[model samples]
Target: MRVTIFILLVFIPLTSFSALRFKEVFYFSERSNFSDSHYRNQRPPYYFPGNFAKEQRVEPKRWGEGEAELMEEALSELLSLPQLQKMFLFLARKGPVALKRFAEYPGRVPGGLGRMNQGDKKIGSVKMWAAEQPSFYVGVTDDFFKYMGHLDREKQVKVAKYIGLHELSHLYDYRMRFSFRDQQFLRATGWKWAWFLRRWENQYVPEEKRRALMKKVEEGEMSLRDLDRIVREQYGLPSFYSVTNPKETFAEVLAAYVLVPEAKDFLRPEIMDFLDGILNN
Candidate 1:
């Protein structure tokens, strides 16, 4: 019985949602089975930023699950906060959540992300959002932290929290509106910070090299081992995933903005203003 349950847990975490369903997709791992003791006494690196309740210490509620389940539930609770909720409401008002997609492809091999520093297509929501209607998904393999080299439970929570922050940044890329008949979708220029990231990518990465990078990404060639190289070599970006594209850069910055301690080192002065603008804008 224990063996059967284990196998089910291993393979059943991924529940697919068809593209045409227009319903949100949610796929999360049941990795960690941690208790309140794990984070109840711990402090959140930074306060979740917002106009109201601006300094609240935000952390995931305790659960009797593995590392993966903690990340999944933590994300839900984090997004439920009014601070984050308000932001999502604003985006929903603008684009409206008609046929909006939300899926999770968590890393589950237990050892590594065989190919791609990120994913076979793109890391996180960027790839799905890059689609015709800007569908989005947050991609994480178990090897992510192992590769980014973050296995600590608390740090893992921060990773999950930031994934939410980053993916929402991608959601804002499209304009969702309701027409007389049904709804209309249009492409819009992303945030100013995203544009800045593009310029940075262009300036730092030569055309040929940039093209090569794209090829590698399309081929899922980047690996966890490559994280150190990108982190050490990136031009002021927060994480290697940040270098993937403007959306990723924007999302990563968003993640870093609300972080503290281990992940807080990546924040910059301008990012403070950027974060404020995002919260208030």
Candidate 2:
């Protein structure tokens, strides 16, 4: 599990939503088990931003017995959260919510939280990859049973809910296509198009510092690992991983807003106001 480098909000433990009168919005049911041969010897790819090879070829595997039920429980809790329910519904309307678990590809990608496949068609819902080792990874490494061994029912649900929003928010970003359609969001997060590079660049770092940072990275004067450190130091963003880019920043901010109310104390007023306006709409 990746430890958060920017920890601005301390989570207050809350009781599971099972005790509340919760209405189910998204249903996580078992789908057809995936085999490489079923997809015709070609593994479907999952994607993320940054230089980590944009996407990875993935072979989807069926969730172990009873796993879908556990995931459903977590989804139910997610819907119970007042802050995320409307936004989730708004995003889901754009596409069907599909969840799949896959074998890890050979690489350094740690499968941090989960990934969105975004699928091939531009007009519909995309396939989503859940974490291989389940919620917290705990004592397990790619072993769901061992990960579960470390958590009782309550903690299991809590961990599931925590990751659930982050992954779902990725789907929201994909469905919305914020990069092309939402300039306000991108600008608010401090991302601007660099026509020269033909990609979006983080503007949180001052122009001079950004130029120097890139020069150092290209010349191997600075390690790429230091990139996230600089972004966090300059922007004091919600999370270290969010510093990766704007799409991730959007997801992380939404997840923090929903899961940690205290995040309001730390997030910039513009960000909080933006989230409030969008979610309420």
Candidate 3:
């Protein structure tokens, strides 16, 4: 029985949602779960920013100093988490094996490039770069540490840890699971679609010139409804991509699970059912 259970654990492609569900139950069972205790210990006195501009300003220099400190602290704590350590080990082994098989195909993967890097300009948010060898670079801005510090410290740390885990998952996937050839195929598909759209746009008549054509498309004049169809159509693409790729979908699900327990309540019925399936499987 023990051998069977161990084999199941090793072979199963445990979804992020499933892992989170297990974590929830495990943490609940443990008397010293850090959720409440961590928060209570780290609570800080209130101090709100005086103005909107003050809040919006980006200061990379300042953020760098704080980010470094936070990163060190977070890394230390992360290394100590047994569950996270185990997950990392599993991914380290599993990711490369998956990638090797994927690399044999001469097509772009269904999802966009699975990796990204920090560019010359420091953007506040992380960005993805599609390349022969995809990699992710965590962007740190001046407000990074300050913003994190401002969070209900205990709650925020948990959030940060979750974010780190999610990003790490991506790293593992790219290193082991994603293939350059697959990405190239997907990129070609995207280009073909872009070309089709451009041709379609150019064929519009004089009465439906650029502005008018844009307005019409914006108003969904071409589609079944005369609503803002273009934006709506574009909005759904991410959902499709999320569904097709387990890595992307899992990372997102895991991030949400770690940061927001309330998310389980708000998820779509289909998604909730999916999560249940992952957990039970």
Best by TM-score: 2
lDDT of 2 by residue, 163-261 (tens): 567667766666566644677777677778789887767776644555666567556675444654455445755544565567777877787677764
Using alpha carbons, what is the TM-score of model 2?
A: 0.58
**Stretches of model 2 off by over 4 angstroms after superposition:** 1-57, 105-159, 206-236
Give the CA lDDT, 0 to 100, for residue 164 in model 1. 52
In TM-score terms, candidate 3 sits at: 0.34
lDDT of each: 0.40, 0.51, 0.33
Best by lDDT: 2
Q: What are the TM-scores, per candidate, against the unseen true structure?
A: 0.42, 0.58, 0.34
Model 1 CA deviation exceeding 4 Å by range = 1-74, 80-85, 94-155, 158-160, 176-201, 207-234, 259-263
Per-residue lDDT of candidate 1, residues 1-281 (tens digit): 45554444455576652221111224432222111233333344323222324333222222233645544454455555444554565554453332212222211211122233332322431212222121232344333333332232433444445555555566654332111111111011122223544543333444466556555644558644354246524544455555554555556665555553454454444454555655666
Cand. 2 Cα-lDDT: 0.51
Q: Model 3, residue 142: displacement in angstroms?
A: 4.0
